[model samples]
Target: MSKPVVLTIAGSDSGGGAGIQADLKTFNSTGSFGTSVITCLTAQNPDGVTGILEVDAGFLEKQMRAVFSYFPVKAVKTGMLFSESLIRTVSRILKEYRAKGQDFHLVVDPVMVATSGAKLLQDEAISSLIQELLPMAGIVTPNLDEAKILGSGEIQTSQEMKPEAISLSKKLGVPVLLKGGHLKHSAEALDILSFPNGESLSYSKPFVQDFNPHGTGCTYSSAIASYLGQGESISSAVGKARDFLHSAIVQSFPAGKSKTLNHNPD
Candidate 1:
């Protein structure tokens, strides 16, 4: 039961599908201890999100301080920080830790939209994430739509992914995982990993037909964070994480009416 402690600073999903739920489940599957600091709470099901309640920024930092006081987190990830204020607060805490020489990595999932097409991150949150969060992120995982918002506009095909991945990585000075799950009519789901050092890699898995899953982005980024937390290199972490996520998605099943990834025992 001895595993490296990893932290997820994200929103609570009442649906138990994405955000903190998906992240903690991935940590457990990938052999890491998971701790969480909830930034907000969402009333959502597999079908959609109905409501949201954000935590106070001061209390959010309090949760972070409490976690840091006990466990030396090796890697951390952020999901669904719905406000610029929330984004700034989290970055400030991480900056403080880095100043004191606490070694850790950050995985930022720019969660802009839900599986059901609802806007999760407010419009004002984008600049905050770019200015305050992305610079500190060890890697940022953005789906096709998010990639468009981040820099490359309207990336509708697999061809546009690599350049955007590289460009965004160079622009942010951090590794970027540009996920190609939403590209229509693609035979295989392609994901491009662009490193800040001008290197890149691509991983592809056969698209799971009929499995339009929820929590996939959350689960994938969490797996990478978990592997990195366990001292795996970025390349190894993402490669292994990609494999793990493929299997999880392949094993997906229905939760009531909506499809969801079966990350348990992954």
Candidate 2:
């Protein structure tokens, strides 16, 4: 039997706790073979991101094409595509793959703001993302801040989060996973998954008291995609993935001066 193949299209985290590094770690931990197409390079640590250098759109496309041309990718997850050009290029590739009847499961983590409140995506790129790529995504995972950015308002409570998830799913024409990690809460981290068919699932797990969790959002979405590549239903995959992320956070390591590194069982 061959291992399921999962590809991550995201940025390079030199800190080794987030972006492409974290995605690959989550994929491997979930029993999938991982591949990556880096969109940007960042100088960052647990404290914050110091700098960002985006890869040229042409080179980024080349990397994606190279992987798809040779590897049998079962699923693909995207994070931190910094520019409108990169988003459009990725949209084109997705269209090409679909036209060829290769409909790989796609998980899009709309990484607009960093953990330390730095704006990761360009202001002009948000509209392009919604117009081009959101509709093509199988699942869109947005943290509270990203959701607010997308919705143009604050989503601070679970009641406000539910309808917004459904509305975003309808607006984007895909399932929406509204992550509740950024909410000010004490009980548990609650995430809502809403589909276009009016079906919704809510997942909650005890929030680990680890302030050093750096790549948690990236890890969670990629873990879900890895499970989907292994033929699990979306709801079940998300539930299991949530459990996996909790474990990873619980066993997280202090990697840099301030942040903790996600554990990869690979």
Candidate 3:
């Protein structure tokens, strides 16, 4: 069977739990062929990130060219682009592809902080991400802190997420999936998907406790991209992805003192 090709532009996680590793796993699980463009490399484990090495912008561009030129990339998801130069390079090259009428769905996971509290995206790159990269996205998935940084007021509850998601969607001129996983006080994990046109949908599941996996964000966004690659609508993609992630978390097992998602849970 010929599967749809989904591309992930993200960092490499040596732990094999997040970033490019997670994205590829999710893509494969959700029935897509996965391709990658490495933006950075991280020496990290579930406990914390030890160090990072940013890929040169030229090499990043070359990777993008190699993938896009050869594969019929139906969708792309981006994670941890560490610098302003990298963000700009990605924006420029993707824009060039779009200019040539090569349409593909883009899922932007606005990854700022890693699960272990390491800063993935640099502060200076944030403005570039907002101005250049986000506008090209089909959807932007941001956790609570990321939403707050993306110009939302304090979001401490699921109810508070609605208005913030709406506002951010309008501000970014794209669909926003404001993730409520950080609201540890809540019994249910809630995520609000709001569109620029004022419509919204809620995706809620019982919060999985003691299951902090390293790659959940990377896996979730890539699952959405995989579904989009399979021609699902945005709302359907988000819903299905949310369910996919929930299942992965529920079936997770330990990996060297920290838990990692069971990407192939059957």
Candidate 4:
């Protein structure tokens, strides 16, 4: 049987633990063929990012067109679009593809901040992402901090997550998957998936201790895209992705003073 093709449009992690690397690994692990359009290149490791070189907007459009022109891309995920121009470029291309009657699930991983506390998305680009890119997504995955920025105000606990997710989903006209991994006080890592219809799904896993989840957000969103590409409903995709990510976290291994998710965990 042929595997569904899923595309990841994101930066390249020189460390190989996040961004395009993690996304591609998760896509294959979840039974999909992975393709990529690198938006930028990051010089970094599991420790921290030193520099970033963004791809030009025109070249980004070229890459998108090249991929969609041939492959039957079933799903596409975006991460770390560092600038306003790139965000608008991506949104326009996606809208054009949809206008041409092409069908594909778009998963938006609103990666604003890196695990190492490096700013991945520019502050000036936040508005462009919220306005131009987010509405085109089938689901937008945001961590606690990103959620707080996109939504109304501060999110202190998991209790505050649900309503904010619901509100964000309604506001964006897309499903919102609010990741609570940042809520360290909780015994369980809780994630909420809120639909515009006022429905919500919760996924909880025993939180791993002393572990740095370097590529988790990228992996989770890509896994969802892979599942969605395989024809699963959005809710089912989130559930499956959660389970996959939880397993990867539990089966993590040591790498350069930190741990990396075992993307191909057996």
Candidate 5:
């Protein structure tokens, strides 16, 4: 049997700890063939993002088209689309691909903020993402801060997360994987997966006491998409992905002077 092919459309992390690098590592670790289309390149380390250079929208579209034309992409995951034009281009590609009857799984990790407190997406791009890409997503993953931004400051607590997830799913007409990583709790990391079919799943893991777990959200969502490409159901894929991320965080290593890189399994 052939391994599944997974593609990540995101930013490049110069530190090799997050964004496109992390997504590819997670995908390969999960036994999938990983590919990438970089939206932006960041000169960043664990401490902070020093600079970012975004690729032109035309070039981004060309890259996406080239990948789709050549590879049998089983699943596609998106992260750190930094501009409104990039978001729209991605949405257009997805819409066109769907029109061709391609059932490519899409995992959207709405990466609006970085672990070092840097804003990864433009403020105007947030509206574009919600309006354009959300409806086409198979699963939209947003951490607490991203959720609050998406919800317009409505979600604060874990209890509030469920309703917001449901609302977002309904409004966008897609499933949502609302991550609980930013919540100031020690017990468990709870992530809510709400589907349009009126079904919901809550995945929770014992919180690892790692303060420098960078790229966790990217890893989890990309892993889920990889598992989905490997023929797992959504719930099963999410469960396995969560397990993988927990283990990775449990065995994390300090990468830079400040943050750590969660280990992808050997």
Candidate 6:
């Protein structure tokens, strides 16, 4: 029995908490063969990012093509595409696959910010991502702050998240998962999902102290993509992803003066 193939096109995290590292772990945990195309290299850790080196656009495209050329990729997840050019390059590759009649189950984590309060996506890149990359995605996952930026308003309460998520999903022509992780006062973390079909779903988990949740977003989104790679429905995938992420938080341990999640917890 061959494992299903899935790909993660994102930055490399030297810290191994997020980016390509987290994606690969989630993919394999869901029983898929994980492949990757690195977009940038970030010197990151539990504390913060120190430096970043982006891959050349041409080389980035080449790496993507190399994977698509060989693997029967059932799902592709994108994260931390730092520049407009990089986003464009990734979008073009997806378009090529689409043109070839190869449907891609794209999971786009609109990763604009890092847990350490560092900006991961460029201001210029947001427009290109909105116009080119997001439409191709089967789903887009954004935290409250990111949703506010993408949706153009404040989503301060659970009530606010629904309309914004529905609005964004309608605008993007795909489902949207709006994470309420930033709602600091909530006893439990909540997330809302709005599908293009006008249907909505909600999930909640005991809120993990967000202080040093190094890869929470990455892990959650990667889990969704991984489950999708195994042919799970979007809602089911989201549920499992939430549950897995909650467990990761439970198993989290201290590292480097801060705490980091157990991406592949036993």
Q: Residue by residue across 71-130, what tens digits does model 3's lDDT show?
A: 888999999999999999999999999898888999999999998899998999899999
- In Å, residue 153's CA in model 1 sits off its true spot by 3.1
| Per-residue error (Å), model 1, residue 137 | 0.9
Please provide, for model 2 over 130-166, each residue's C-alpha lDDT reduced to its tens digit, 9 standing for 90 to 100.
9899888889999888887777257767678788888
Off by over 4 Å in 2: 259-261
- For candidate 2, the 10 contiguous residues with the lowest summed lDDT are 257-266
Clash pairs, model 2 backbone: none
| Clash count of each predicted structure | 0, 0, 0, 0, 0, 0
lDDT of 5 by residue, 152-199 (tens): 246656787777777767766888888887778547788889887667
lDDT of 6 by residue, 1-266 (tens): 98888889888889888999988887777678899999999998877899989899999989988998988888888999999999999999899998997766899999998888888999999999999998888999999888877863686677777777888788778999999988867787889999877789999888767447777888888889888888899999999899888888888887777677777666
CA deviation > 4 Å runs, candidate 5: none
What C-alpha lDDT values do all the predictions have?
0.90, 0.86, 0.93, 0.92, 0.86, 0.86
lDDT of candidate model 6 versus the reference: 0.86
Q: Where is model 6 poorest over a 10-residue stretch in terms of lDDT?
A: 206-215
Top TM-score prediction, candidate number: 3
Q: What is the C-alpha RMSD of each candidate to the true structure, in Å?
A: 1.2, 1.6, 0.8, 0.9, 1.7, 1.4
- TM-score winner, 5 or 6: 6
Clashes of 2: 0
Taking the tens digit of each residue's C-alpha lDDT, what string does model 4 give over 88-130?
9999999999898889999999999998899999999999999
Return the candidate ranking by lDDT, descending. 3, 4, 1, 6, 2, 5
Q: What's model 3's overall lDDT?
A: 0.93
Per-residue accuracy of model 1 over 133-228 as CA lDDT, tens digit each: 899999999998898888866787888889889988988899999999898999999999998777999999998886757889999999999999
Q: Indicate the residue-level lDDT of 265 in model 1.
A: 43
Worst 10 residues of 4 by lDDT: 148-157
List the candidates' TM-scores in order: 0.97, 0.95, 0.98, 0.98, 0.94, 0.96
